[model samples]
Target: MDIDDEVVIIGAGICGLATALALHRKGINNVVMERSETLRNTTGAAIGIRQNGWRALDQLGVAETLRRTAILIHRDRTVSLDDGKVHEILMKGEFRCLRRKDLIDTLYDELPSTTVKFGCQLESIKLDPNTSKPVLRFSDGSAILAKVLIGCDGGKSIVADFLNVKPTKKFSFCAVRGLSNYPNGHSFDHDFVRITKDNKFLGIIPIDDHSEDEKKEAVMDVDDEVVIIGAGICGLATALALHKKGIKSVVMERSESLRNTTGSAIGIRQNGWRALDQLGVAETLRHTAIAIQRERIVSLADGKVEEIPMKGETRCLRRKDLIDTLYDALPPATVKFGCQLESIKLDQITTKPVLRFIDGSSIIAKVVIGCDGGKSIVADFLNLKPTKMFSICGVRGLSNYRDGHSFAHEFLRIRKDNKLVGRLPIDEHLVYWFCAHPYVPGDERNWEDPEEIRRSTLDLLSDYPKEIQEMIEITDVKTLSFSHLRYRAPWDLLMGTFCKGTVTIAGDAMHVMGPFLGQGGSAGLEDAIVLARNLAQMGSIHVESRRKVTVQGVEEAFNLYVKQRKMRVIRLSLQTYLTGMLLGASSHLKKLLCIVLLFLLFRNPSGHIDYDCGCL
Candidate 1:
């Protein structure tokens, strides 16, 4: 476990090996550790390298070798997959499709003997107290101390944790690339082709003639029967529900990992618990958070308090726990991380939904479910108008008191001067709280940092109880977040269509409402259960007949899902809208209107949480 190396690299992919080689040329000793038994060639069959890439290869002394075996691309074409529109552009610079194995092999061959240590998996990294150097611990229980560490370990790198780097933002699309052989000469010109429609894209590049006239291409795979976009709570839950019914689905998430920890916590009531129970993760998740017994409403003006008993099972869970539990319940490889959806369109021949990703890859699915959130690209494909934002914004975070506090296990809400502050205990030592207020023009100028947010929140509550002030002041800044609330208009949900062909939407993509009702998370869970139930019934029919899911059959199922969910979501949206109006209304007339509507439509405020989404 003792080493004299000055630098260490954790990966032997193209980047890791290339970095080590660069360091070697600079007279720096470095070791590249690869967990794989050999170099990876599964990335793709070939890569299209342009002029800059060739220059980089030249610096590494591999350009000439690659040039000898790669075909030059001279022309470029952009084709619209939707409308059959084609535009051809003349090529200018150097571009070629070299086999990825060729490049990887060349890099590996050029490296010094024994430079890469295979089968070394990095388990943990900590700083040496004496030398201030990084001490890397491998899974084999060996440790190495190095002066510097470089992470070229692909996207989900463990080394990233050592640097405290924020996770990369997830996009809405992913890619697929492969090598296709054409023993018979292909008619394609010595040019590259870029095909696209909406957010979808495809690229085709030819390899050298000596390589069996092979071409690197990105095309849609027609084998995917069910494709769910997003790996959030709704997406994973839906996938799990389907899996429970013997229906397999691919959950495509743009993020490299599970749900973002920044979502803080989510309150799951009876309906959400029902959905989780049906998904087979409820029992395990229940131990993560304590259940609520009652809701305590406090009025700041008169120090008055009112309590309402919480009826059914209700618990506040760390969003990470819920997402992790749901994900862990499913079979391996069921969720495909980094598969961001770019565009989706109906195939002219089969009429099935074809989804394209930003990574130049695509897949055709018999049924496409959009569990993507408020800014859903799938909803856009359905031509649904975007959700509207409210003038009110919420600042939320977690407050931890290491020394256990003596607070009741109750959901507390306090209101004064049109501003509302709410707090609920996550456990004996942790609490989740939120402050919502009207949007003041340029007020965010003071809320830039966590300290600033804390300061502003404290100032806003200066006249309130001292306990509240102390809680806000001592909150951990990393958990602080502020954003405006947005919701789909109630009217839109009533009259708008939620299904097109065999594609449909769920969760926030379907019915996004304000937090007034606290039903957003539960509603999405309900969506997963209901949607899976309908699909299971439909899939059972197909299984009995030994036939594939037809477009008409899928469409019928989606229509039924919409039919069952439409009015319920509309009612939920309307209630949240009215509640927001009651709090943020600028004039007396609007306030009266909202109050009247609330009383007429919702006789009981907590009635929304009483219903169940049924079993999977």
Candidate 2:
């Protein structure tokens, strides 16, 4: 096989496609081989596109298209799904919500049609035993030779397999997702919504047309729409942020769609907001979100109801509306409808990554970002392990009543066993409720079964006030969702070695954390942005040494990438772990201590951490 190009890409997911576009921008037209028979569309809905992600999209010339379909949410409000009470928090500036399809379609459109080959599954790599150049063989018996290959294939990648890279299983967390149609007369207060019970978290997102009805009609658009995400809030928020940056995205869920469950009302702290603002989607979000002036904390056991004025600003927005806005902002091709990543491989000799599909096909790419989540295949391929922290389990849902609901509020009703319940108001029509309980590791309780989890949650909260108990009694089990909390260690040798040749990891693959600090998706987007920038800046000559183009430059660049991202990711992972520990404090004394410490340190000044990387 004769080498014909400078680079070859495997897979066509966000990472692969984004890398292709980046290379294209650098005047490099690489071949993108996808194993699927067609573009994938079934991977599920919405992902967070942070400021960093937005910057990359902007640089790729898809920002404006994304903005047109996305909803910019400046605020997040937490409300009691049971009591209709609200607690509002302001995000500095961040756009939330874009459908997965919208984002993929947009990226696809940017590439020259000739660059992508659909249904070209990689069978094996034929290395030039003498020269070491890589030859990629396809299932169809055709082959192409390339100087450099990138494994953008996901976890379980064949590219990684060929290179003999094995990823370690960190934690066992599986996610189920579903989408709901927009309801009539829905009052959406924030762009993103979150409800936490013990160790579980549920996120709701709003999706809508950015243009007014009349304008949409004038533009011959379809009816306004929104998506409800039942996964962890961080994942949902990441998708939302991407839309805020003007990248369209969509989410397809595995479970039955819950059409009647209204979107969530959650608050966004300063840390999340600042990241959004830097991404250039903050202005639009501010227009529709509610700013929080104070946070009211109510503890039933202590009879302590304190109204603490918010030091730094916080905002609230309706979750569904945010998703709708993000969807509207993105180009149609940005997301695929049902593409699931089954397996992946990283090929070092040929230097291109490959992905093996469940359907018996494959795709190859330059880089693979593991935003596929905690039990990520990419993480597994990289041999990264997760360190077990405490496990949390909880139930969440929306309630119909909405009287005396503040936009931003947190009611901590401490019952037996230190169980806590929180309520947030998304709008006048609905509230988001959460109940959390501690659990030991290896507990086999099924959190996804709403009826069972609801019963257990109610049992835990039975000793609370009559009002609280009444709210739980009347809650709808059909609308409820559950989650378990887990954390990955700050540093792992496997992740450090993920980039053997042309393969790398990102998002949850590198670090999966509990949703304590709300930085999960934000951090992942940051990774994508940073990696894209580094790859974009490196020239072909710079990527390869003159004397041994195949031997030196590529390895140097890959090594540099690992070094640059390691410290930052490790810092975030540690921060997330510490934050989760503080939030999940089981002892009453510990809770009191934490509350007092928070009041003393977090009241006068914004307690939010800044996200300035100071890197291009």
Candidate 3:
């Protein structure tokens, strides 16, 4: 077959249709091919247009055209069927809800009918070196030549197969969605409303209804018990806790796959052990992790070594293993990958938070735990930002597979000229190490590259002991990590209690001191256990009063949790920050002062280490 079109779109789904429409407006002729019979086949589905989506549509010059026929959604509602509790939230930014067919029809009407060829399924593709164009063979004994073949076809795309591009598969949660016909008027004030019952949700949006058809609304039957915003350590831990309590929560991770900030290991301290024990993973971790009763510190200037018996309870566990253990406890389908949080709106009635994903999906949780991270968007919901205020920066990573480290599992620290290198054995095959340096004005954003970081760290610790230097040279570049390691002071927590309505932050999102004391990961576990306890308590509460009273109880519990964590986190955060200062001490006087302070602090360990939130 001979084709004249310069561009051929492989699919006529939303992406293909939109691209074709944009090309049409640009006076660039393009053909859209669809295997589907008709656009109206998408009749029952309603698509949400968030602020970002609206902006993209505006650039495509279709925003006004679509908005004229779309329903503006500003208010959202969630009702718990367990009791008759209803929660209302005020939505922000521009939101529109319209039927999928209506959107397709509008985009289709913008183009000439012949622009899209229906029933033309793509069979195979051949790329020609001369034109560098794609030669497409269709299932209907027809062929087309395209200057540019854009595969907008979803997963299982034939074009993708031709290019040998594997489609990324994600576990999709089950949803039963269809049009709920209301021949009579369905009375509702808000444009968007979602009603949820035991493990099932019914989301309905009033139709834009340009036609005289009697159908009044669209219904989305989504079966989900909870929506967790982040898939990091705390997010996974909280999911496990909820799982143990018979409460199912789906973790929403922005990344296509798991990102191990815990690339290698975490210091599971006494507090971490307590929280893990409550979650029932303590024994497993203990078997895997090395108990750290003391740390060996070496001074390169004098070639002297001293061992310090650490007071705070500490254990070094592989970062990946800890996260995997927590994540494994829950059902596999409970986490949704590639679902990044775009924005969050507060539900005024229940004070619960409404989460909006980058994909335009909105979720209302009975409670939303913000375990996103140090630069948490959920933390921003509290009107704060992570201040990059630490004077010391560190690069950390685990060595590639080896037979095993020869020594015991105790931590090793070597210091010279304000630069320090610390190593802890992660397993027989892998050892975790961190290289630290004093903050230099020029050292901004240099840690982005693994090789560059490794080299720079080598330069910083040039005069260190031979074995420590060999560790840096021989370590695999893939496992290395460098970060500013931020922390929040009291001012960042704000004047009001940390818990606002149904939103609360945990892990590095709430407090981010350096890993000097190795308590960063441990502190996060504490947050997870405490928050889960409060939320589970709310779930267990018998609703004698359904509406306002339930809100009060939830809010009171959140406040108490914040109050309980305040003193504990503040003390640890300060100590961890101080430890960073001690690690970077260069002058003789400063070193002496650090040694004395550390000795005293080690002798009189704070009661914080022994404290435990009574087991769930």
Q: Rate the local accuracy (lDDT) of all candidates.
A: 0.82, 0.57, 0.72
Count of clashing pairs, candidate 1: 5
- Count of backbone clashes for each model? 5, 152, 2
Measured with C-alpha atoms, the lDDT of residue 579 in candidate 1 is 93
Per-residue lDDT for 373-425 in model 3, tens only? 87788888877655456677778876644446676667788877677778887
Ranking by TM-score: 1, 3, 2
Question: Where does model 2 exceed 4 Å of error?
Answer: 1-267, 278-280, 283-289, 305-307, 316-324, 387-389, 402-417, 440-446, 470-479, 491-501, 532-572, 582-608, 613-616
Every model's TM-score? 0.67, 0.50, 0.60
On TM-score, the candidate that comes out on top is 1
Instruction: State residue 165's C-alpha deviation in candidate 2, in Å.
Output: 62
- lDDT (10s digit) by residue, model 1, range 460-518: 88988899888887786767877788899999898788999788999999888978877
Runs in model 3 with CA error above 4 Å? 1-226, 310-313, 348-351, 444-446, 490-496, 542-550, 584-608
Show the colliding residue pairs in model 1. 172-340, 172-341, 173-340, 174-359, 175-359
Worst 10 residues of 1 by lDDT: 210-219
Residue-by-residue lDDT tens digits, candidate 2, 1-616:
4556658888988888889999999998687888864455446777766677788889999989988776777667665665566777776555667777778878988999877777677877767787778888876557877789998888757778778788746566667776553322235654577765555657777765322343323321111111111222333333444343332234322222211233244455665456455444556666655565665656666677767666554555554444444444445533433444566665556545565433233455443444556666666666666545455655677554524343344323343344657665444545567776676567576766777766777777777777666666656454577766666776563345655554455566567676555455556546544544444345122323221112244356556767876776666666555545555776778767766655554463333345543333
